[model samples]
Target: MHELVSWGRVRLLGEAGVQAGNDATTPAVKITVLGSGYVGLVAAAGFADAGHQVQCIDIDVARVEKLRRGEVPFFEPGLREVMSRAIRGGRLTFGTEINAGHRASEVYFIAVGTPPLADGSADVSAVYAAAKTIREVAEAPAVVGIKSTVPVGTCDAVQAIVDEGARVPLRVASIPEFLKEGTALADFMKPDRIILGVADGEAERVLRDLYRPLQLSSERILVMDRCSSELSKYAANAMLASRISFMNELSRLCDAIGADIHAIRRAVGSDRRIGPQFLYAGPGFGGSCFPKDVSALAYQARQAGVPLEVVEAAGRANEAQRVYVRDRALSMLGGEVAGKVVAVWGVAFKAETDDVRETPALPLIRALVEKGAEVHIHDPEAADNFVRSYGLPVRCFENEYEAATGADLLVVMTEWRHLRNPDFPRLRTLMRTPNLFDARNIWTTFELGKSGFRYLGVGTRST
Candidate 1:
């Protein structure tokens, strides 16, 4: 695979086991990944791919065994092969125990998930639990790297957790990932920026030495205080999520008036100011990061006596976007939702990821089922997860057309790589009627015109 060789130069890139030149990087630390879920596994695999002596630790033995066998438990495009090669080559090792890992590792990265809670805050119990384990067994003076998307005071909280029971000083730093799930390896090796929040003396040199590869490439590595680093990650996601919500609001406007959003987007993007990224309208934003991180930030902000009105508004807008798409689908089907056969193209939150934690398709599927529609769904990697979660109220299709066969309508939820281009001839044959719902507005109105399908795109005005 291209991924295997592409990452061979990885030891020359980011902060795992980067090559050294100037008076540093002598005796690079043993990097350890704590957790084996999407973020944890990917981070672990990437560092191992980077030629670092990486030991991946998780509580789940099945997950660990899967990694050890080169069979990735999830569907990340380049992850499986790369992890497999590394595991085969003895650069990467997987274990279920945490204490042995802590004793052996020099840089312990905590990449566990921070699922949301009822109190509208991030439940960071997993992170604290990991720290408690590290405190009990670690023999080495380690820099605890937090690669998780945590709340603002999280690194500080982790520091307190470790320090409270720790015999030696357990330094904690935030190195939050900006990776889109499927493209994690690419993002990790060639990131736009690398964030490091550390206290002045002890951890700085270790961090600087570790990240010499990125410095060579001249990528911006922002070195800030630990708290700022933690907040920066949530703030970054909030801004991106807000942009999606903002455009979805405009999408509704485009539907109302006789305005094509594609034209407007082109016109607006032509200016140097707005740059046309995250500008497309969709069936609301979903996936693992946006909803959880934004809500977590909002909660943290409220606790600090400053409610994030704008961010909270964006979250509400994203939720409404899903409702808007469902209503539009119902409206296009002449407002009678019962006995409707709706074929949905993509089920994962966003393309290139199997993660459907808060995917729009899940909500829309639930709505379609409630309204008595026979929902047929298709996704590259999310089908199994969807089936496991929802338990087959909707039919899972092997191919896109199979899902579309005899359907009254089609809803394109996630913008998968292949779904951007479709076989209109086959699509027409499969459908009961020629109604298409373009939630991502991927297909042009001109293309739809030539195809002779009654199209309902998210932002574009109906001609």
Candidate 2:
């Protein structure tokens, strides 16, 4: 965790009486969020739930219609319920554009996507478009908060766009989001730190008022410049990704030297300086944030005549880790996977969400299919998304046991809650070869050899 301290124009909340700008006594501010994607929708619903009137805008007409009918396009654990409740309270609404109805909004959040381009730079076209839209539709002096994860100086660039031909004073600020996919709503409602990247005191005050509800129990706000705020999101994600890649590299060393990576991890994480978090050694780190952010940061660094070697290496290590899992599975099967029945237990990168953007399972499954292996997959929530996105030639099973039936090998990818424990006896009876490749190390606690099965786990002694 980054230290919450006062440094170089960065101040903690309440320092120098800054908390007086916004407090519990102030009424909830009207908010309009541009883009109804994961971050946008969650922010809209969370702000509404906090008693603020919020209007979520999107360019996708069909998605807007669905949201208007209380339908969420994606699968987040508690978002639908919160959104539904907010809609019922009349505090949350959805639309395709920022029309006259949203003119009274005091804060506008640009929550659009900043997808990676071919060279790994963030494609902030959506963010720019949202700024132009705000400039055209916004009626009053509103604080334009950026909730999108963008490269450094993006907020400044957006400021230039919004400042042109603007009828009102639209202040652009970087309020980048750090919400995780599985626990986005909780992360939003109780954020670790609310970053306020503002150029002027008015922008800070208005955003502080907008986010005042989340800061009831304690002060969790960090005030800084827009560039630093934009860079902080990428820097945080890159550091976490580097930790995961470092653990993965250690896991491979453990595999080669007949040592337990878990034991080493326990000792390493015991140190107070390195508290245990993001230290789990799995197939590899994957998702929308880590990989993209690391790559984008590296790209941005290179553009500035500097290079982030650690961030670059982290990206390479993740790809190598995925290949390592794939190669290990094939080598265990006597270096031949052709015509073998392989069951993949989990498809999502991690648990509790249906997002599979850069899941390690993608490359592994693709390699399996390319090697002529019959791949069967089962995930509690991500099967449909995996199928629709990859279009891989694999059997999708509704049940984990069903997916394992008649399988020569079972490879566990994501650490879904239910996948942690399984009927070993039933699996032994169902599998043709009874070989279990625990890529996630979720079954390391169980002695599978006693169940008459050959078990192989990452960084664990093969049985």
Candidate 3:
């Protein structure tokens, strides 16, 4: 068993004035990141920006070409700028495959996607394929770090694959990412903690060296066994998801008892143990990480004969929350929305991200359409993505008021910065009916009621 170690203040050879992404003292290392998805692309860009020569590899020819021209395929704050700078500086490159010329990397990061399967277990086939490719192309000894969130024993299985047909010794380490979508660049630059699951000293040393620049103030690297590191990622996401689900469950109670969730959340979050984070009750917890990771953790536990009841309950509650939001909207529309014009503001799961993988707005919009309601939607960044992903009959507009024009009800699903404060007077004039459903609870009931609009918020008294 590898001992869990926490190093304090790593003393590097040249560690003076180490700024994130601009550390000159850190020696540049050649890195080959497999996969160009969210996690992979972010890792590739972050490493290159941190004074490392990075080559991001992906199977998609179109995506690779787009990345070559410095066109990021997704919306992430500050990602395009960082990637552009690295590309211009000749430190970052993109490729479709691993070749003989790309064999000099001392560290190889497998940042492929391990999407959840039907049984709620993660499908690590992409991860295994990346490992196989790295094993085939590794001419010198290299550390293969798994940045993909995976099962507990996935690293061991990958290690076995690398050891099968290896020209040189290859080490497998679990370096699971804990990045959030909107704040990915900042998260990478100043992570709360970096988990390094390594069996050998070489893997740990190389990964530590690569991540040393980011730990200038204090050491935030947590070194542990591979299984523990892999499990930690799932556990962290599960905990956050549980908090949101718990609050959502309470939101229903608040609605029933006419209690304000904002007041309750403030009182509950004031406790030192439960700081204000993920405590707000919204439509539901919908994102790539929380839902999938929670379900995957529960599934893995059940397979091991130890089911995580709390985690399982969190997933069920999330599903229930989506239904509750849809049902509440229907209730507000008098249970018969056959020809009502409903304008939905904010289709993305959260602000600043175009990812609609499991956005809460999806179910609500689908339910509205099924109920014969004409849904018009608007999002600053995610409108196009939402339209492409679901292809619903809803009309998508560039402007929020345009979506709300001639609408009976305006439902605010996402809490984008611009959607927080709207021209209520203009909204009332534009809409056929002055009904507003503040699903995100961004608007105050008193203000909306004073604006001569009927308003309903999550876990707040309806006006």
User: Candidate 2 lDDT, tens digit per residue, 1-463?
Assistant: 1121221211223322223233456655667999898899999999888877778999999999999889889889989999998888777888888867577568899999888999999999999999999988877778889999999989888888988887777888999898999899999999999999988887787787777778889999999999999999999999999999999999999999999989988999999999888888889888888888999999999999999999999999998999898888777677778999999998998898889989989988998899999999999888999999999999999999999999999999999989889989988989999889999998998989888888888887778
TM-score of each: 0.92, 0.94, 0.94
Off by over 4 Å in 3: 1-25
lDDT of 1 by residue, 8-44 (tens): 1112234433322323334334677889888788877
Mark the 10 consecutive residues where model 3 has the least summed lDDT.
4-13
Query: Which runs in model 1 stand beyond 4 Å of their true positions?
Result: 1-25, 99-102
What tens digits encode model 3's per-residue C-alpha lDDT throughout 134-199? 988887777889999999999999999998887777888999998899999899889999999999
Task: Quantify all predictions' global Cα lDDT against the true fold.
Answer: 0.79, 0.87, 0.87
RMSD of 1: 6.1
RMSD of 3: 4.2
Model 3 backbone overlap count: 0
The residue-level lDDT of candidate 1 at 92 comes to 76
Total clashing pairs in model 2:
0
